[model samples]
Target: MTDQLTYLLQKLDASAHRYAELDKYYEGRQPLAFLSPEARTALGSRFGRMASNIPRLAVTALAERLRITGFSDPALWADWVRCDLDQTSGTAHREALLLGDAYVIVWADRLGRPAVSVESAKQVTVMTDPGTRQITAAVKRWEDRIAKTSTAVLYEPDRITRLVANQIGAVGSGFKVVDEIANPLGTVPVVRLHNSDRILDRHWHSEFDGRGHSEIDDLIPLVDALNKSLADLMTTSEYVGRPRRWATGIELTEEPVLDEDGNETGETVEVNPLPESHRMMISESPDSKFGQLQAADLQGYEASVRVILGQIMAVSTLPAHYVGVFTDNPASADALRAAEASLTARAEARQATFGRSWEQVAKLMIAVRDGRDPQLIDDVRVQWADAATRSVAQEADAVVKLHQAGLLPVSTALAKLGYSADEIAEIRVARRAEALDTAGLDLGRPA
Candidate 1:
């Protein structure tokens, strides 16, 4: 038991650094950390850790779109509501997007219902079976940095074990079993929300044990480039973006004398120093003529910024508008839809993956409710809200066009426009009643 717990703890310790680093990037602190001391001086003391934060925008855009409205089963949906998952699940989704993984732990509460807890990747780690890719063991671990102690719970197929060790962040810190419970649930109750998980054949994240990847991996380099461009622009604006004035022929003399009695104190200075360029600086000398130094052309800097932003948009799968990029011309409907295509595809992909994990959570909740493993409700499905980006008017117009072309029935068109089954049923009943009323009125009128 000691050896097994030690192994999981060691794995968790190894992964914690990665989780913290990703979190820093998602919070917009990573780019500025790389700023050289000279760059910081150039940026000014007032500016500390300022960057574009487009990575956060990218992560947030996808996380907000992956909404779980409910489950297909009423009982499961009810359980979800009881757990307040509709609100709490957003945290889980965001953490997964930021950290490459998140965890949902389900256990029986005192009320005989499932209790749900959300955990960041730093707090949890799992051992997966190579052939089946199933979690054979999982751990939720916590540490007190000041106290230098670690407390953890390990979930295996047939038992739950709690272990604690002092001298955390040290080598060979042994963990002793503090408590144990036999598992009647028959399987691990921890569900992982792993972002960008890839099959071993196609996996590229060899650095972190070939585990799941994250949006940060694609965004960080782009963000750094973008920040560099922004910083350059700022520097140019501060020092050399605008024109400087020169007056070589000016006869301005250096003399200064000031006292209450008008005595010469002999502190020499330019007779009339250069005034702000916003106003005229007329020299008294007949030959005095002002020449302007050419300002640095900022167009190229702006173009570089846009180019880096384009790269960011491409890598993050975010539309231009999401990163606050837009053209002089208002975006056409087709253009808007085209821009959102990749983003919509990414959201749907997440739904398909995160939905599987949510389904397992529902099953685990059912296990808690029934006091046994949920082998019966294997077909549980998660109902996700539509992540497609389109205005209602546009969708309605498309539906009408499809109906007019005889390509889609009214019901199917309504479904395409995101009507629920119950809402469609109600509409059908109301339409039938209206038709009957019209027929009765026609019969009574003159036929």
Candidate 2:
């Protein structure tokens, strides 16, 4: 059952992706609004009259053909919400999704004045029977056509409470996203795509066994299952593609800002003395040290791996030993611990403050000494990842790299690194030109 579930999920996911691709290509090339009346007539004449009652294709039907029943429409959303809600209790459960009553108000004037007076309000409720748990939605529309502006809600016991917590995290916490996985079925594809972030190593495992009993008895196997799922799906999809043009490497190689004696003068953030050719393009070359490397080259992967290693290395630092050593000791351990602590502090600060930690800082520091802000290094990684995901072909693996490294926020990270958003945009354009040049393709031809 599990194996079958996994296979079905993969098929569904792949099918959905194919459909999305078709939708995008069709939408771009053929816009309903852009069609002239003559063209419309011509098409109609050729293909017969358009059906007014062209039935909406059921997602289940689509998924069935694609072999992805688990991810089909109401089944996907309903199961996802249910699984997610099951993880919470009390307020969290309520806040995540609430079910209650909502009133739809309509204004009407019987006397024929400038505005309509209050006519009537209809009460709507989403309720589930305690005995049967058969959920039903009840709504009373004012007119035969039903009020278009009417608002309806489900009275899930705990959604509102969860929403409040999420709101607080968004406002008070510096982090941008707080994601959790709730997998009711182990072999589902949506769980993999919706959660399993590569950087954080977060994935979903069934909380209960196949028979619906708690599977938390041994946490190891569950965690291993989740990890295995992530590993399997790691390189299957790309959110964006790499640039199309050939990149001849960065210019401005003379170290532009050197003094008469050629000693380092400006701060790390100071403009690189190199000309346009040597200028760093975060979008093209996220690993600043190797600006023009191909996406196929292991440079990005190696760089990301190094960043993760750095964080892991930093974890070895101990504060207690470093804080009290004073005798005529070599203090090698203390020194190492302090350095690690500094790195750890910086990483934790970045993660806690913004949900993203600078995994590329150590790699960038190797390119130039004096410890530049990890934000700058991170920005370059993100921009490159974004470019790859957005531009590269769907089959390309660049999207997987970006998604795995959690480097999609390159522009924002660059902004934090002291580059204005506009400057970053210009840099992206230039980098895109280089990548496209390298790939022997044109960047401006539409997308």
Candidate 3:
């Protein structure tokens, strides 16, 4: 047991470091940290400070655009899960989009109302059984910087426990468990949300077990190049525009002159080809012309920037138009679809992983709210929104065709077209009422 705990602690420490590195990249800091000291010095502070943050932007864009298309929004779950989600601010969706690894901890608030909140990756570490890949435990450690203390919550299958320590070692260091307590929540109250699963030679690892790769991993180099290029351009522009003043073959002499009192008075006089002046004073010699610094070719820098952006678009699988660059003509609908195919596929893949986590969250929420066994709510599933862009008319037409051809039911078709269960039910009720009113009028019978 001690050896197992030590190994888990070591893994947690490594994960913390990995998470911190990812966070730094996402926040656009330390872009040139990997460079050697000599190389970094050569780049200077301006280049070091210039961060395009394209990687961050690309990842955020994908996460934001990958909307949750569907979930347990039917009438069966209206009171149990949907209402609770509304009260909790739809945390599952928000957390899934922002954090690659999201955790939901369920508990009852002071008023005994079931509550759920997203936990930061820094504070939560998940432990899973290697064979079954089932979460065996989840440990949450938080430190009070001001109080010089730390607290850890350990959630297991049969119980929820707390550990308090006066001082906790850095990530991998084993902490002294000074105190422990079991909580009222009998079962593990946390669920791990992974953006994607990692595979290894027919074996699978949870996102928590390994370092999760970000969507913008391939675009980091392009972003760095773009920023460096921009910094160089700015420096060149400053040098070219700097104030220039020069003087040559000029001399100053002090001459004695008689003042009004007939006493000797001295005054400095310019004894050169040109008068002393703040402006560029040209000398009489033909070889002494005013020198001017030529500006660098800004067009070249602009072209390089465009090329870097193109590379980002290609590697990230994002559309050129979406990245703020466009051709003379608007892209056709088919072209647009083709361009977004890769991005849509990536979003769908994320949905597959994140969807399951959401299902677990829904189950936990139901358990907390109704005091039912979470394991019993196994049928909960997530519905993701359409990953592709389509016009409203196109979507509605497709759904109507499917419904008329008997390929899909009206309710299902409406749901696929992004209609909520409540809206679909209301539409059906209104249609029935109109039919009844028309029959009562007897307009078809008489006319």
Candidate 3 on 1-447: residue-level lDDT in tens? 234344555556556665666566678884663455665565576566777776666675566655554456453346334345443424443344344566777776666556677686667767777787777777777888877776766677776655566665433234555555454545568877765457521212434355445565566577778777777667656555354445554444455666899877775444544443545464556656455455456788888888988888888877777677766223676676777788787777777777777677677766666678877766787776687777788788888998999999887897888876667788999999999998888866755
TM-scores, one per candidate = 0.79, 0.14, 0.73
Error of 1 at 337 (Å): 2.1
Clash list (residue pairs), candidate 1: none
lDDT of each: 0.78, 0.27, 0.64
Show the lowest summed lDDT stretch of 10 residues, model 1. 201-210
lDDT for model 1, on a 0 to 1 scale? Answer: 0.78
Clashing pairs for model 3 are 68-385, 69-384, 69-385, 70-383, 70-384, 71-383
Task: Give the per-residue Cα lDDT of candidate 1 at 123.
Answer: 77
Ranking by lDDT: 1, 3, 2
Q: After superposition, how far is residue 446 of candidate 1 from its true place, in Å?
A: 26
Ranking 1 against 3 by TM-score, winner: 1
* Model 1 Cα RMSD, 1 decimal: 5.7
Which is superior by TM-score, 1 or 2? 1
- Look at candidate 2 and tell me the lDDT of residue 78: 33
